[model samples]
Target: MNEEEIPDKNIFMMCEALNCDALTELPASYSIRSCRPDELGIWKMMPFDDADSAKEYEGFMSNYFTTTYSGKEELFFAKTLFVCDRQNKPIATCLDWKAYDEFNTIQWFKVLKKYEGQGIGRALLSIIMQRLEMCDYPVYLHTQPSSFRAIKLYSDFGFSLLSGDNFGIRKNDLDECLPILEKFMPKKYFQKLRIINVPKEFEDMVNKYDTNQF
Candidate 1:
């Protein structure tokens, strides 16, 4: 199934400041590190792991790597990270990617379902944010209404929703997403969401790439 066949809501966000207070220590049994070359397949599938979505993601990831990391496959694998269990099996993954070689953006951040409640996500995000701290300001990311929990986590880390009509080739669903969030998220978490205008620099960088493949 191609992703566009399924209806989805997309939202864009920006973080002007890193909130160190949101950082948490990883549980003792798991370790965080760069992904191994052999784990490229694992890194690609972890976030969108359901069998039904496999076809869609396989296509998406293939295009993503080819268009976004073409000659930088080695760098992609080196920068891609995983939170591994005691057995060194990857349970979660993400990376601090520079979109269009202009500014920082968080990409493919996810934790396996069984590992969800632990501090692994926060810990991994904190480590990535630390790596991105000096690279650029106002980091950006793309997500959806379904990821309300992660959105709350992002807000805790100082990311605010971008209230605008578009982000690159994608339409901003911030307005539509708010009602869904309010209906689905607990009132407190939903209430804490903040909004910000899109900065020209971030807008330009996002549009810099011809992301039709994505």
Candidate 2:
């Protein structure tokens, strides 16, 4: 039967199976309490040694920061957690704490697509907030103005927009116009400020384009 015709029980089983398959693909040592290996083929389908080393390194560093720090950093790390299906595959993801002290920013948020909305996003957000409450840090995040659904979710969870800033250009503002033009313009007319480390042919094409006037 087609997806819409499938019974809720079957649909849930399918979703559970998909999640379990995903978990098996997770990196070694990652933990999940809800999903177990024997309940599905999760362990057999796991990535083995084929997983990307870079991804493993990133995970290691994140775990290290959480373990090494005791104060804010530790709290931030605790806030950042990942949950996957039985296969250890990530269906939804979020960062619990991201802080740039110089910029006075602390962002705790999740980004999930429509198809992955099986209440996973809400559950992940709730976990972050629970950890944050213990740490006593105010939680905040940034999103596009177009994200009405996300805005509503945040509002329902007691977040409010403090201010808004316009990003694009406006014609009437001459002061803004000058800066915009200057920002986009080349310095010394033909001088290249950055270079792409590509093949010789690509570099030659870029140089040729740089010399040609519009």
Candidate 3:
């Protein structure tokens, strides 16, 4: 139920902001910055101490207890970031991914519920967009309509949908991509979206990103 690319009102939307693409300017309020070298280990992920009831959340993220997602390499680790409050506790998070080059994307992007209204999400996203500015490739993300305001944040940052119309994934890999999608997403979500081949946006960025790695 976690890997499906199925588009759901609640499942979060999948979108991307290509490097240097024109963006709709928007003002931000919060102070957003990347984690320092020393804080990387401690600020790797959002605090989810209770792994006992992960299903109770929207995604099965809590299943993994670390600050960062599983299988991340040093490159992914350096790209992780946090939003600290006055006391320096990380209240929001975002991560960079490259396991599948074309699918190089930002994942686990969220602001703790208590910090939702202060524009922390947009600040996090804005800084993320800046990180991708030097890449010839695009920065990818996934979200859903149920998150009303989040959609606006993405659009404002120049993210647009990646569908069969705009994206064209190689046919040979469809067989391999299908299983991964099915494992995480549900069929019902795609039924409503009718967007064929979510993986079509994968742009072979794995090799392209090597030079960009810190």
Using lDDT, give the best candidate's number: 1
Error of 3 at 186 (Å): 27
How well is each residue in 181-203 modelled by candidate 3, as lDDT tens digits?
44443455322332334453253
Residue-by-residue lDDT tens digits, candidate 2, 52-77:
64355555444534443335643443
Best by TM-score: 1
Candidate 3 overall lDDT versus native: 0.49
lDDT, candidate 1, 1-214, per-residue tens: 2323323788888998898899888899999889887877777788775856766778887777788888887888888889999998999998887777777789888998888988889999888888875548778888888787789999999999998886678888888778877877789998899998888877776676558322
Once superposed on the true structure, which residue ranges of model 1 sit more than 4 Å away at CA?
1-7, 212-214
Error of 3 at 100 (Å): 1.6
The true-structure Cα RMSD of candidate 1 reads 3.2
Model 3 TM-score? 0.53
TM-score (C-alpha, index-matched) for candidate 1: 0.92
Please give the ranking of all candidate structures by TM-score, highest first, separated by commas.
1, 3, 2
